[model samples]
Target: MSDEQIDLLFHAAVELQQRGMWEQALTQQREAEGLLRGQPSGARRDERLAALLYGTGGSLNALGRHAESAGVLEESLARYTELGAAPTLIADVRMRRAVALAATGRGASAVIEADAAVRTHLDVGRPSDLARVLQLNADVLADHGDPDLAVASADRCLRILLQPGRPGAADARYLFLAARRASDLHAAAGRPDPALAAAEIAWTSGREQGFAMPSDGLRMVVRLRESGDLRTADRFLKELRGLVPDADPASYPTPEPSVTLAQAMAATGATGVPALDPRDAEAPFVPSQRSAAPFLATAHATALSAVCLSALPEDVPHGVRLGLEAHYLFAYASEAQDSDLRYRFVTHGALWARVLLALTLALRPGDPALADDLTGWARAVVARLPPTTAEAVEIIAAWIPFLDAQDA
Candidate 1:
């Protein structure tokens, strides 16, 4: 009976590991493993042994003992098979084992196990768990000396996550976690734009919950790519090699974001697109004036899910005249030859383009009315203006993706 106390200790160890207390978690895990080994050999004892082994193996992995974790996890897997563990548990074990194997330099074996683990997850895994397993598969593939396979795995994970309802995954937090991995993979694969978009989404979501992202390196990479200054980027990378060769630990006051959580969350649903800077003192998306009618009514009527985007209305209020007033500011500025407004458009084109894409996603491929209406409205407006102006040309270019999808 004394050995049964290992179960409680094992659970606590897992909790500590999750909280990033690796050393304490490892100690508790070893204690649990030792106590379980003292138990009499029986059906219940075998099940406890399986669980304790799994916990200890996981703790080892958390503490970066890849080879040891792999051995312990393999033993746990055998005990799980012997005890006939549920499919989910079996799949979860495979996922962690794959990670350990990859870290231990057993690339081929790791990939095999990862693929099997994903298959198992697809059959019975919740979206939250599935996203994590997919990310693990991607990371292992990356370390397996096959960048292509790694990129493919990462892309697959994004597809699964952004699969309409699945993108909502478990919650905003989980979605961002998956998105962050997706961002890194995309960036590594020479796709900076998508990487930047993914990072922005993750950062935005996390910031809404007071979570700060260490995205200094990511931002620099993206800016370097945009500037197309390869030599400068290369030189910067070289400088980074020894800049932090040695460091001293220091403590400072907890930092605060430029915008508050409530403000950031509010901006998530707004149509006003602002240039993204982590330290920008101004709110990004609050329009100077509010419209009397809803613009995303059609999207709301269709199948829409996710955080703030899910809270729109199904239709414009009966008598309200919806208008794309926010979008017209650029056109009006160009027409009036307003230098300041034109400068904003030139400087923030990318963010505005991203906003347009976000808006376009609300259009369901199966339903074309909204897209048709938007296209025709833009066409009509541009027809009345000087089409050769840079603003006019750029605006149309921004809409090309949505228009092409409609044509298809």
Candidate 2:
């Protein structure tokens, strides 16, 4: 209940924190706060209470109680402000709060907090600390679909980390992280060359600097290769294997191609479409697990038509139409990383959907109205896909809108 006892509890909490006993430390800090607040409230009380709140907030963030961490950190900031806390201390708490906010999916707010930290660190001339806020800003921007700024901020972080005469392990680690994130952002933005370059930097820096990376990042090289440079894939794979000798290539995820209509029908134990002859029913569509982000969806639409048109069976009544629709479906089924990629996929897939619908009408010349059913089938097929995001669900719903009252 006394001041000495409160001080002892706070010191014990700090000790627990030093030992990585965050939960216990949280409890100790909370008790210290209760003791401090039990006395008559004053400037000292506010300062002491703010310190307790700061410790509790940090522990909560470490425990991944992000929303609660943000709330407590905000309270700490308000108290600190009331007590006229130093700029460095305020910036430190704000930086932690920004991380908690980002973890809790408040990207816009997280950006603001991170920017504040960056400004503070800049004024204090702590380039290493500022690099953290820079990376955090980049990540939040990327999640918010601002890939350009994300890439830029990542580049800035890397520049800052590499400025020191002899960059230490932490500097190298941050540089690697920034490069990796920059590569992904570039890829998402459909800049393959830059993406490959960033991936190369990330992988090479991580290895040469002994950064103790959580992963060798081999998959990124594969992605770079798959996006445009097939040659790089082999080289990166070999380099990654050498860099991480303990890693198992077999353990890497095998990309699963999208299920074709024939495969889906077989899986569902459904018969072939009644319109097509039994002998010519097996579709020629070969769906792959690919998204348009690394490329344009419109390009896939055009390419799929050019590639599969000749292979389609014109001998059967609706063979060409079925094959074309199946081709587009295969291309559209690729899982996108985010809404932009999904939107592009759907946009391209819809173009083929319309063309196939027209062909269906021509095939059934007697029943021109049957075009609606064909379009409906395409929409339904696309809708059957497991939507991963709200935007993805919207894209599915609008998949064949022109066939009905809906628009692309």
Error of 1 at 317 (Å): 61
Q: What is the C-alpha lDDT profile of model 1 across 1-408, one tens digit per residue?
A: 575477678788889987889889889888877877876888888887777778777878878898898888888888888888887887788778988877765554565567667657767987667767767776765554233334445555555566676545245555565556556655655566666666666656666654533443334344354447567555644544344332211221111212222233344443333223211222111111121122222222111112222332332211011122223323233333554433544333332333333333444353244335445444444334343557656765766665566668
Error of 2 at 167 (Å): 3.6
Among these predictions, the greatest TM-score belongs to 2
1-408: candidate 2 lDDT, tens digit per residue: 489999999999999998889999988888888888788989988888888888888899889998899898899999898888888778878878877877775543454466556557767847787777677666655553134445667877776776757356657767777888877665655566766677777877877976535354664655666477667666766766676766553464443222233332333333422221111213110112122232433344354443333333342223333344344333344322334435554554454544454445454444333344345455654654455556446546555455456343
Candidate 1, superposed: residue stretches over 4 Å from native: 159-177, 206-213, 220-408
- RMSD in angstroms, candidate 2? 17.4
Which candidate should be chosen as best, given lDDT against the real structure? 2
Reference-based TM-score of each model:
0.50, 0.52
lDDT of 1: 0.53
Each candidate: RMSD: 21.6, 17.4
Steric clashes per prediction: 0, 2
Candidate 2 lDDT for residue 359: 45
